[model samples]
Target: MIAIDNKLISDEVLDEQFVCDLTKCKGGCCEDGDAGAPLEDWEMKEINDHYEAIKPYMTPEGIREIERQGKYIYDKEFGWVTPTINGAICAYGFRDEKGIIKCAAEQAYNDGKLDWKKPVSCHLFPIKIQKSRRDPDMEYVNYEPREDLCKAACSLGEKLKVPVYIFLKEALIRKYGEDFYEALEAVAGYKKNND
Candidate 1:
């Protein structure tokens, strides 16, 4: 593990390879999960604030589910998460013409409807972060690509020689700032040179 500040990052971030193959997977990660994409407390407010602006990008069913379930729901196992359509796909996700699940919030953001992107959890997919159980102030950054959903990503990553951390550079920086990302990169560079 690479320790940085209050976080412990798993070695898999540098060793494991991954690059989302949207054509092959069709954004399965967005829809195949048992719960909706995880949300921070502030993200719930962002959804509530930008609902009208983002509603146009969302499916009718998603809007209805949001109305029925309230913007986000508290999960027993995962704390807060976006509401799903009847416990299926995320209510914020819409199936496109190519059958890929697209995030309405992200679409809205790209269209200049809101400043916030989709949930950080969604952006940082294949990599999950959680508060450390042993130390309340510490966090754990883990590489956790789904075996069934991410097979193509893994294969492509190997072909491209892109490490999991490299594949997630933007997301990591977005979530943890550039310092953390540089720290991870430095570790990767050091390991590569020594090995």
Candidate 2:
């Protein structure tokens, strides 16, 4: 583990190679999870504040789920999360013509209706962050490799020579700021040279 700025990063983040192979996975992460996308307290407010703008891009069922469930729901395990339609696809998700799950919030952002793109948790997928149980202030950011869902991504990443840290640069910067990302890059470079 690498400690940086109150966050502990798992070494797998530097060693592994991964770039989302959306064409192969078809955004399965949005639909495959038992609970909806995890939302931070602030993100819950963002969703409520911008629901109207995001509503048009969502499916009717998604809208209904959000209306009935009040944007998010509490999971016994996952705490506050975006509500899912029929306990499946997220309340903010809709399928594209190719059957790929797409985020309505992202669509709204793409259309310039909102500044926030999807939930930060969703945006930083495959890289999960957990607060330290003891310290609370410290976080552990780790690369979680799901072989079944991410095999194609692994293959593509290896083919393209993109490490997990590099592949997730945008999301990491979004979560931890540019300075943190640069620090991580420095760590990656050092590891590469030393190994």
What is the total number of backbone clashes in candidate 1?
A: 0
Tens-digit lDDT track for model 2 on 141-182? 989867799899999999998998888888899889999999
lDDT of 2: 0.90
After superposition, the stretches of candidate 2 with alpha carbons farther than 4 Å from their true spots are: none
Worst 10 residues of 2 by lDDT: 85-94
Clashing pairs in 1: none
Give the poorly placed runs of model 1, Cα more than 4 Å off: none
Query: Candidates' lDDT values, in order?
Result: 0.91, 0.90
Model 2: per-residue Cα lDDT at residue 108:
96
Per-residue lDDT value at 191 in model 1: 92
TM-score of 2: 0.97
